[model samples]
Target: MPKITYIEHNGTEHVVEVPVGLTVMEGARDNNIPGIEADCGGACACSTCHVYIDPAWVEKLPAKEDMEEDMLDFAYQPDPARSRLTCQIKVTEDMEGLVVQMPEKQI
Candidate 1:
């Protein structure tokens, strides 16, 4: 399992032990962490699960695919350099200690 840290807009942090195969959005939801709506159930069709990867971990993630990039257009405050759909990020062993920040709004 990998541990992922989710920071809310107010600086609240939730550190969850996520299984290696689950998506980041699923990890947050399963652990009762707020801010990740995942309205589309981990599909790339929605932006409610949008989050900002911590600067240090940004380069460790895979490049965004076309669908993810298009969906981000609907995120609350899109930052191309950091905004990513949590559903698209898989929890891998190498992602241990990964940190992601939630946006102020999800709609």
Candidate 2:
């Protein structure tokens, strides 16, 4: 299992051991973490699962595709350098201990 840490707006952190092949949003959703809603079910159609990749680990993640980039345009608190849809990031052994910073809002 890979571990993921989600840091919330108020600086609270929730960590979960996520199974490989699951998306980060799924990890958060399954663990009852409060920040991700996954409104489009990982389809890249919504930005409800938006999150910020920790700066230190940003380069390790897969680059955003066109669809993800488009949807990110609608994210509530978008930051081109750090924002990403959690659904687009799959859990993997190499990604164990991934840390994500959640925005203050996700509408």
Q: lDDT for each of the candidates?
A: 0.94, 0.91
Error of 1 at 55 (Å): 0.5
- Residue 103, model 2: lDDT of 89
Off by over 4 Å in 1: none
Backbone clashes counted, model 2: 0
Put down candidate 2 lDDT per residue, 13-63, tens digits, no spaces.
998899999999999999999978888888888899999999988899999
Q: Candidate 1 lDDT, tens digit per residue, 1-107?
A: 98999999899999989999999999999999999999999978889999999999989999999999999999998998999999999889999999999999898
Error of 1 at 34 (Å): 0.6
- Regions more than 4 Å wrong, model 2: none
How close to the true structure is residue 55 of candidate 2, measured as C-alpha lDDT? 91
Cα deviation of 65, candidate 1, in Å:
0.4
TM-score for each candidate, following the candidate numbering = 0.98, 0.96
Worst 10 residues of 1 by lDDT: 37-46
